[model samples]
Target: MLGPDGIKDIAKMDPREGAALLEAHIENFDGEAAMTMWLQTKPKILYKGGARSRFAAAFHPRENKFEVEVLFSKAPTDFHPTCNQIFYFGEELELALKYAWWAENRVPAEAACVLQVALPASKMSEGVYVDDAKRWERLVWHSRRVDSHGQPLEAAPDTVVSLLNERILVGPICGMSPHVVQGLPRGGWQRLTKIRLSNNQNATQVVFMNPRTFVERCEEILWVLSSVSWRGNSSQDLLVMHGLRVQPLNVGQIAAS
Candidate 1:
C-alpha cells in the first residue's frame, strides 16, 4: 500500500509509466479530481516474486497432483516471529485460497479496489522442517482436526468440510476446488496471456495478477501486502497475500513476556 510518499517516489522514478497510468486514472474521473483519486485507488498487485522463486504451480488434474519446486524468497524479518508454522508442498495452495476469499469478503463494494497489502520474507513456509520430527505432517493433521485453540474443527453452512466428509480428517485433494488452485503464484487456474521475459523485469509482474494467487500465498504466511516497489530486486519486493478482515498476528498483539 503506497502512501502519498511512496507513490510520489514512483512518479519521480518512472515518469512515463507513472504519468501514463495516472493519466488513465485521471481520465477515468473525467479529469475532475487531482492526486487524491490515485492515492485512494491504488493498484492491488496479484503477486510479486523473483523469477527464480516459486510463484506459480502447474496442476495436472488428470494426474491428481501439482508440481512447484521453485524456491521462494524468505519471509521478512518483521514477519518471521508472527508465523506459527510453515506450510508444506500442498498446504500452501489451500491456505492461500482461503485467505483470498476471506480478504475479498471484507472489501467494500464501493471501494475502487481491495486494500493494498504488504508482506515480509520471514512469514513464508520453508517447505517443511528438515528433521525427524515430521512436523509438517503432524501440523497438517492437526489443522484438519482441530482449531487454533485445540477445539474440534467446525464446518460452516457450505464449507469444504460440509461438502466432503473426507476433507474433515484428510488434507485437501490433489485436485482441490478451483478457488484453491486459482491461488497459484503464477495466476489463476487457467493461463491467460503468456507472460514473456523482457529486459524490464517488471514486465513479469503480471504473472501473479490473479487475485487468488496472492491470497493463497499470503494465507500461508498470514501477512497482507501493503505496497509494492518496482525499484530494486523485484524478488525481494515480492510478498505474500492475506486473509480477509483477518488481522495478521503481530509482536505487539501477542501477550507480553
Candidate 2:
C-alpha cells in the first residue's frame, strides 16, 4: 500500500506500479464515509522542490463521482490556491489509479505536493463557497469605503478622477454631470465612458463591470472548473508560475474491486 513516505519514490516507479499502490490504499476502505475517516490521517508527502503537497479526496454520492485535489504551497505567508490541481474519476478505484499515474508521469519534476487529506464532496464545495463569499464581502467593503487614493472620497475633481482610474464608478456616473466625466482622464476612461453610453438604453443605466480584482478572477476560475465536463484528458495553465498542473487521465480498466 502507498504510505506518505512512498510518494517520494513514486517518480522512480512505473506509472502502473504507482497506480496499483493507490488502488491498494483505496480498497482498504469500505465506502465513502470510511474513506473520509481514513483521510483524516492527513498524510504529509513531499515531491519536487521540497515543497509540501496537501491532498483532498472527495466522493459526490449524488453524481457517483470521485475527485482528488492536490494543493501546493507557494510561500509561508501566501494563501495557497484553493486547489492547484483537480482529478475527477467515475469510480473510486479509477480515481486512485489515475491520480497515482498522473502524479508519477505528469507532475513537473520541480513540483512538490505538500498536503493530502480526504473530505466529503459537500464539505469541499461548501468550503470553496465560504471562502469566496468572505473575499467578495471584503472586496465590496473596500470599494465602498475608499477611493483610488485609499482615502474617503470628497467633492474634488481629483478624487473623482482617482475613482475613475481605479474603476470604482464603473457604471453610469450618477450625480456627476457629463462635463465632469468628459473632463476626467483621456485614454481608458474616455473609451470606457463612450462604450457605456453606446450600450445604454436608459438615461439612468446601471451597468455591472468586472474590475478583474484578484477575488473576481479567482471566482471566474472556480466557476469555469465547476461548469466544465472532465471526462477526457486535458490540461489547464492554472497558476503555472507556481508549478500547479491540472489534468485528466484515461482509465482502461478498474484496478481495485
Candidate 3:
C-alpha cells in the first residue's frame, strides 16, 4: 500500500509540477494543499475466546466524511476482493478501497472469513446499523473475513473511544437512559446485532459511521488500522502500509496495495 513515504514524495516536487497532478486528480485541493483523513477501530473480543470485531476507533488524520467496512470472511486476515465498493457517502473513491484493504489485513484469515461468510449471511440485511444521525456510507468496503454469532461479548464505556479528548463523567450505573434533561442526552446501550455464524452461505455486511468526521476519508484508515493490528501476545511488532490505486487517489501520490 502507498504509505507515509508516498505522501511526502508528492510534496517534494515543484509546486507547478505537483499542482498539475492535483488539478486533474484531487477534488478537494485548496491552493497548493490537499488533505485526507483516516479513521480506525481495532478488533475487540467479547466472549473471551470466541467472537471478535474491530470496533475501536484509533484516531489519525486524513480527510472527512468517509465510510468503511472490512469483512472477516476467510478466517483471520485473508485476501480482499479487488473491486472498489460504491457507497452511500464519502467524496473519494480510491481512498475508500485502500482503507478496506488494510482492515482485511488486520484480521486473521479464519475469523475474517467467518465474519463475512457466516455471521451476517445467516441473517441478511442491507447492512449493520447504529441508530444515529449519520448516513451510512458504503462507498468502499472489501473484506474476506467470516464469523458466526452469539451475544457479542459485553463492552463497557471505555471501549467506545480509546482516546477521548476528555474523560466522560459516568458514575451512576443504576439510572435509566433518559435520566436527565440535557446532561448527555438519552441514549441506550450500544447497538449490538447478534449475527449467527453458519457453515453454509458467506455472511457479509459492511460497517457504517454514525457521524463522519475530519481525517476520516478512508486512506488514513489504512495507516491507523495497520498500527492497531500489531496487538497480541508477541513482543515484536510488524508494520504494513496501505495504498490505493484509483482514478482520484492515483494522482501525484506514489503507492499501492
Candidate 4:
C-alpha cells in the first residue's frame, strides 16, 4: 500500500509522466505527512563512541532482530567518550527516526537534487573487524554465527549458557508480549538480544523473545553495516559487523559510572 505499484505503476517512469503520479501517491499514502514529519522530526542518533574516534556505529532494536548503523566523520584531539562500550568493533549510535528528518531536510537546497547515505566498506569481513581501533585492539563489536569468515560455526549456542563462559554481557530481547523468560537464540525465539564476545576479534549478535525482564529500556540494536565508498576495495574479504542500536539501552536517568 505504500509502494508505487500498490497505488499505481510509478516506480519507473519519466520524471514528467510520474511527477503527478508520485505527487498523488505521496498524498494518498500519507507520504506527504510522513515526509513532513520525517522532515520535521529531529531524529536523534545515539552514538556509542567517544569523540576521539574517526568512525562510529550503533544499533536499533525494533522487534525480533536488530539493525546496526555506523558513521564516519572528522574528530579532534580533544575528544570525550559518548558511549557505553569503549573497546568495541565499532562505536554505537542511537538514531531516532523522527529526530533525523528535521535535521536532514533543513539543509539548504543545492543546484542538484541529491540524497546520500554513507555505508560501510564491503568485503572486509575476513578477520571480522571494522573499526581501526577494533582491528588494532582486536575488539569484537558484533558477530554472526562464524569465526572471522562467513563460514557457519557451532560456538553460538541457542541458550544464554553458551555466552556466559565468554564474559560477554548477556541480556534479553526488547519487543515481545509475555516474553519468553529464558530460551535460546535459535529460529524465531530471539528478541531484543544482547552483545557478547566470541573472541578477541568479534562479538556474538543474539536476539531474545523477552527484553523487559533483562534490560530496563530497549531502543536500538548496535551492529555493523556493510558498505564501501563510491569506489573502494572489494567486498569484505573478511567478515565484519559494526554497531547500531540493537535494543536501545534506555538512558532515562544518567547514572554515574
> Candidates' lDDT values, in order?
0.25, 0.25, 0.23, 0.23
Please give the RMSD to the true structure for each candidate, in Å: 18.9, 19.4, 18.7, 20.2
**Model 3, 153: alpha-carbon shift in Å?**
1.7
Greater TM-score among 1 and 4 belongs to 1
Cα error of candidate 1 at position 229, Å? 24
The estimated TM-scores of all candidates read 0.21, 0.19, 0.20, 0.19
Model 4 global lDDT (CA atoms, 0 to 1): 0.23
TM-score of 1: 0.21
Poorest stretch of ten by lDDT in candidate 2: 219-228
Measured with C-alpha atoms, the lDDT of residue 193 in candidate 2 is: 22
Give the alpha carbon lDDT tens digit for every residue of 23-70 in model 2. Answer: 444333234433333244221111211221323222232332333222
- For each predicted model, how many residue pairs clash, with residues at least 3 apart or on different chains? 21, 11, 65, 66
Sorted on TM-score, best first, the list reads: 1, 3, 4, 2
- State residue 17's C-alpha deviation in candidate 4, in Å: 16
* TM value for model 2: 0.19
Q: Write the per-residue lDDT of candidate 4 for residues 33-93, one digit (tens) a residue.
A: 3233223332221212121112221322223322222231111100101122212222211
The top-ranked prediction according to TM-score is 1
